[model samples]
Target chain A: MDTLNAGSVSAMLPSAFPIVDKDWELADTYTLHFATDGAFDFDPGQMVMISQPGVGEVPISISSNPDVHDRMSLTIRGSGSVTRALGRLDYGDVVGIRGPYGTPWPLDTAIDQDLMIIAGGIGLAPLRSLIYRALARRSDFRNLTLLYGSRDPQSLLFERELHEWRGRFDMEVEITVDRSSPEWMGEVGLVTSLVDRARFSEADAVAMVCGPEIMMHFVGIALTDKGMHPDNIFFSMERNMKCGIGLCGHCQLGAEFLCKDGPVFSLSRIEPLMKVEEL
Target chain B: MAHIIDIDGLDGLIASLKAEFDVIGPIVRDGLIRYGPIGSVADLPRGWTDVQEGGSYRLEPGNTEALFGFVLGPDSGKTNLFPPRAPMWTYREGSFSATPDSTRPMAIIGLRACDLAAIAIQDEVLLNGPYVDSHYAARRSQLFIVAVNCTTFATNCFCTSMNTGPRLESGFDLGLTEVLDDHHFVVHVGSEAGASFLAGLDQRQATSDELAEADQLIDITANSITKRLDTTDIAQFLADNLESPRWSAIAERCLACTNCTAACPTCFCTSPVDTTDFDGSAARERVWDSCFSLDYSYMGGDPVRSSGSSRYRQWMTHKLGTWIEQFGTSGCVGCGRCITWCPVGIDITEEMAAMRAEVLAKEAR
Candidate 1:
């Protein structure tokens, strides 16, 4: 029952411990929660390992903002054992947490440049931090746009936050779902469609992207076609991470260890690894 | 310096080695000779051997009572040096920690010449590469190799084509050549540790005639192997035929089950997984994984090599083509382990020959 605080030494942490916290389902796909002492500092777009006692470990994105507090929050889908166990945890209970691993959004580099954030499905979790960061210092950048898409309306995450964001800044936000209900009145289709529709200066523009792999591929192609430099296009790679550290080669793509080298990488750096099969 | 041990002194030498380090060599396991930790000299597989040819392997009941019986095993000394699973670091509750669990000094008895060549290739990748693997360096530093001259080749073995085995030349602390009537073992000390090791054994110096006998034995062994694959043009052949229809044909047979990688002596690519206890207060663990798995390339939500064809192509290309570009040598030692243990018996040599033939056909047209 020893609670590790900020000053606690690393070697003191137990080998196999869990802090099962309460779970909150965001939309139909996104499930959310914090670790027991989930307040670990993490960069935006970086992930954490979630595991049950006997089952296994799975990589999950920290959906919450690092600037806000010390406690980390994760938005996950109940797809596998760790996620399912994570979904079942009640408030103050415990599960495993082992990261804040991978590179986050380059906030310092985004200064004075146009920012374009593209996200799909749960991919929004990583971009939400960038959105919040940009908006907090909105005057630093010119022309901010956030394009979001998901499978359906029920799958859209952070809807309330997006609504709040729209009201607060002089920014453009577009939300699209693959299929909508009778009340639907917005752009619909794949998220890549928005790439062609949106107008932005490719030069000096830093575009951050996340989402399903297929959608990212198309979006990358579309952005390149639109005169965006591959170097300027940053992507948060999503992979199943077992060790948050670079030692575990699970999240490896070619020479780069995604857990260490990046959760975020420039398109120019990751192009070959992305194209190579089985990485 | 090279010193030869008489047949009678081989047991005493082995006995001394057994007392010092955990002696490991080829032993009978699951109908095959696999390398395992051995406590006694008797644990070595007796009267068992394998013949290796291009994409073919067969167990041979050797009439000679040779303790180190068998061709190159399914695994290599790499398993002992760089294990399938290793924990590099552990993290818990926002704290990071690292612990190194490397191997101590141990003797690997009865190592084949091809596997030794494979280890040399591995050294280039792990030690002499752009980034030195500290774990591999630690384990390799403590290794004591006993290279065994191949009396017979495995069915799928083409080490002669690879210029490795059937006759072992160097890179062993001690070398053995088993002959009928009197089991003669030639000892060559490669390092100071080896010199100190041999000095402890009561073996007399080898005369020039005994050395000639060892060479004759090796020459005979080299000539007995029937299969041969020309590796001179293999790298060029593979590079030229990247998009050839042979890839698809081979892919059709390749199960993508990753048996070849698992059996390969020098295939060191691995992925790690992190796990913690249910309480989240504990640490993280890294486990071993293979490149052939579906999730190896899982970026975002989709895999780049979604099809079996691309996966197979990637595996072979990396082994035969890109490995040279990266490590300055072909990744395969032509030990033929991949062909033998493949559940489908998908012979790499056959695959290469098929591809080469296609290339030839295209050139003719």
Candidate 2:
């Protein structure tokens, strides 16, 4: 038996810091940008565990570009107790953070190939980092396309970024709303409807999707129908993750530990499990 | 020459062990044998054998005067290694601090061969995994194990088929084979610590005949195990049969009371719980969690495993199938704790046999 070095064992700890930048606020949702404290480093599509001292920790996607090493951003919706407490934070309020855990989107697979990004509601938060990463190396990829949908115009996140992305000649940006008011002038219906309007070679495109479970399921089907291989399509999955590492049993989907194995997994790998009812 | 000790020398050995470590051994608790701190050598469950079958366990006085007659109980080394509840961290002002309670060095006595295998399985899951469980690591590193070779078999025992038991091969500080008829114990030193511990005790070199007799007793116990699990490619077989109706069939009888997972020697799943005090302080704790629990797979609102069939399927498949992929070994040690402790008499070996038979039947057609 190997003797264990007691000094090596350490528990999960989070530090306190204030939100440096509060970018945008949508219905029950907001984006908080903070300094990385030089310790926090992450790739695009990875998430961090954030918490308020008395409150609990919740896994939130890193919405900022990876190139910006000094700071990171998290887009959150006040759904549960922890998120509700986070929503009440001001620009200088303190919060705790741990990790930049989980596997990132397979960007290398999309290199030199056309990329189609699909997101629904706040699901766009994680993909926002991927978009920035791709744009930073715009000449490396063939084309960039984004199809984003929200509950309505009021629920749309990163409005400025969407407008700027639409104006970019190197990218195709399409927006849709599930329901529209008189002032709303955009496509209306499920996000899957916009998949037909996007132009990309089915054989050469690498699709990345993030959304509600039902939305991702249908979008996956639509992508498959477009002649894209299941292996080429990737989606982010969400579960009640306690520890960002694999020790906690909360984020298990079949044999896979979603926290470490992936929050992002290929459709081919997870399709069978996805079909299983309630799993 | 094999080192052997007379049955009467157990008191001196326990006294020597108690001088440096907290000696823990089997004791009758609530009519069931369990490992607890021993104040003296008398704490050992002498002449007591537990009758174990599917969904049942009963303590009965044995015919022999053997000290280590009991095969196992509901508790294994896992209770002390990976405790049921451990504090991960505590938060007071605005920061979190690790509160890993320093554990006293312990000498766990009367560990069976199957329980030793279970400890190794836990070592892989808790210490060798991508993220090490600090509490388990701290407690496990300080353990001095005294393994007992099995001389008796329960009806639910299948360690012989699992290739984990009836005799201690390795993974112990010291291994002992109790020869009730001969009134002696054949002691095998596995670690230097065990060798040093033996140096302080009254021991004698055993004759070849005495050593051979101890070996034969272990062989008899191994052969006596009527329950068996055919583990030939069993992991892949279970994985392939994820959608098999056998799971639902077993689920009908499985109460999903989580007794199997709780009693399982190698089930290392845990769930984190956060509790807040009235003083505005909070602590995060990781408690022993079972996959059978409805909230085990909770994703905010509803649980992923909504049906008992799915929960049971997850538990069995993870234990017998995916655990091989994750840990390079089967999670089960064939101790039969799950079978004996289960309220509904759901036997894992029986389930596996049914699945295997179904596969063979399908191939025949």
* Interface RMSD per candidate: 9.7, 4.0
In terms of DockQ, the best-performing candidate is 2
Docking class for model 1 is incorrect
In terms of TM-score, which candidate is strongest?
Answer: 2
On residues A1-279, what C-alpha lDDT tens digit does candidate 2 reach at each position? Answer: 233334463646666667998855686888898987666778887998887766678999999888888888999988888888888888987777878889999999998899999999989999999999999988878989999989988899899899999999999999999999899978999899999767899999999999998899999999999899999999999887888888766687777888889999999998987987755
Candidate 2 clashing pairs, residues 3+ apart or interchain: none
Tens-digit per-residue lDDT, B280-337, candidate 1? 5343343446666787666445665677777777677677766766567788887888
Worst 10 residues of 2 chain B by lDDT: B94-103
TM-score of each: 0.78, 0.95
